[model samples]
Target: MKVLALEGQKHIKSFIDFPHDLYRNDPNYVPELYIAQHDLLTPGKHPFHDHSKVQLFLAYDDQNKVCGRIAAILNNNHNAFNNTTDGFFGFFECINDQKVATALLNQAELWLKKQGITTIIGPANFSTNETVGLLIDGYDSPPVVMMPYNYSYYLQLIENAGYAKKTDLLAYDVPYDTHNDRSVRLLGALQARLKRSNIIIRKVNMKDFKNEAAKLRDVYNQAWDRNLGFVPMTEKEFDYLAKDLKMIVNPEFCLVAEQGDKFIGFALGIPDINQVLRKVKRGRLLPFGIFKLLFGLKKVDWLRVMALGVLTEYRKLGIEACLYGLIIQNAISNNIKGAECSWMLEDNYMMNNAIEAINGKIYKKYRLLEKAL
Candidate 1:
């Protein structure tokens, strides 16, 4: 097998399309949106490129068929914010061939080494702010919206390449019917208790989304500061992401806690659009695919509680529980069947215990891997 650093439109398109063929027979494989992938990979299209660099590689067999792909990424903001010289590898895919997997990994390592990186970690498309981690456990079900999915053998391939687990991220399954309603039942009391301290919980106002997003960004940067691989997003990056999320963000599912105009915490849940995207053949969104996505929105029964956090100074005041409680209540009222509160750090006992208190079960585990360059 030969590995080549991908360049130009044709190669990038091939990189985005390879997974379609590789998982053609897999029932659970959901093709990511083609346009979304294109903008992400193209340098000028995504805000990530303004502060980082990514090099895509493709592995080809003797007959010139693509067998694997990987991306070597240098995230300047992560290093600057965390004070570590770490690079990242993401957008990785390969057949079950050791040769192809190793070749792709070696290429990424070599590229990172040349950039003066001492250690490399990922499956992070850019940073922890985006989709990161490998689907190390729970391969039986398709990943929720914005989550990663891969063949089970990927664990062996990555481990054999001399990479070891850096950390495990947890995904909890909370079915509406089965989840403990204690949190929701006590939500009113909790909100009243918080109100005593001048904190109020309410749905995000889409009419004033721009200004609201700005305030939330401040809390996001502070609340997630201590998380592994956390990197504060620049204004442009946050706005770029907010614009995309605005397309599917439900007002009721996005809640914010405020201390009389000072935002202190927030929780955001998005409809599982994968329910529609799964049927969008090859991830295309033109012609018929657009119609399917538009009409299929209301039929989606699942939600992904992608973000929930409170500023450190305001923790333990029952704000966290209230945020979760409100989201759960909204989910039930909307007729949503279930929700996945995901990508949580395994050792986050506080958050984990809170989810467990609500009867959330650990249904999936994803991992980040690292190797010294």
Candidate 2:
């Protein structure tokens, strides 16, 4: 077997298609959108490339058949924020072979080491802010919007590759029947009490979205500053992401918490686009996929509560619960059956408890792995 740097459009196409080809028989595997993936991997299309370097690699067997692929990434922003020379490996997919898995990892490590990184961690497509982690549990169902699903054996392959568990990301399932108006009933008192402090929750104003997003960006950076592997996204990075999200963002589910005119915190939940994307074969959204995606929004019954946070000083003021409760309220109002508030840090007891308070069941687990270079 041999590994080669992805050097051409042909190789890039192969890199993107490998997973779709490999997961052909896996019902739970959802092919990510081709355009999104393409733009993400291309330097000029992603803000991450502005402050980092990423190299793609593909493995071939003796027959020259593609056996695996991985991305070696040196995120200068991450290193600068943490004050450590750490690297990341993402976009990993391999057949059930230890040699393939180990080889793909070694190639990434070699590249990272050459760039002065001493530690490697991931499964992050690029970073913790994006799709990251290997699904270690809950393979019975397809992933929700923005979540990832992988072969069940991937856990063993990554472990065999000598990567130890650095952290686990948790996913919870809130049953539709049970989620309706529950948060409102449970947290009404808390909401009223907090109202005395001049905090109010309102739908994100689409008319002022750009400015609102900027404020939320500040809160986002401050809210997760101490998280493991946390790195503040550049304004360009946040704006880039916000642009994509705005296309599908529902103001009702995109909420903000404010005091007078000052933005204090926010939470955003998007309709599970996967509900429609699931029918878009190979993640192609052009020919008929766009129609399915556009017309299928009304059929989307689940909301992926993607982000929820309160300023550090605002914690314990019930703002988190308020934001969560309001999202649940909107879900209930819209006839949306359920919501998944997830990819939460496993060690975040406070946030975990908050989710659990709303009857969010821990239904899936994803792990972020690490290795010393």
lDDT of each candidate versus the true structure: 0.93, 0.90
Candidate 1 TM-score to native: 0.99
Native-to-model Cα distance after best TM-score fit, residue 233 in candidate 2, in Å: 1.0
Please write out the lDDT profile of model 1 over residues 296-365, one tens digit for every residue: 9989999999999999999999998898888888888999998999979999999999999999999999
The candidate maximizing TM-score is 1
* Count of residue pairs whose backbone atoms collide, per candidate: 0, 0
lDDT of 2 by residue, 1-373 (tens): 9999987455788888889999998877788899999999998889899889999999999999999999999999999999999999999999999999999999999999999989999999888899988999998999998898889888899899898999999998987687545568766787788789998888999999899999999989999898999999899999999999999899989989999988889999999988888789888987999899899988998899988888899898888888888788778889898988888999999999888977889999999999999
The TM-scores of all predictions, comma-separated, are 0.99, 0.97
Find the number of clashing residue pairs for candidate 1: 0
TM-score, candidate 2, is 0.97
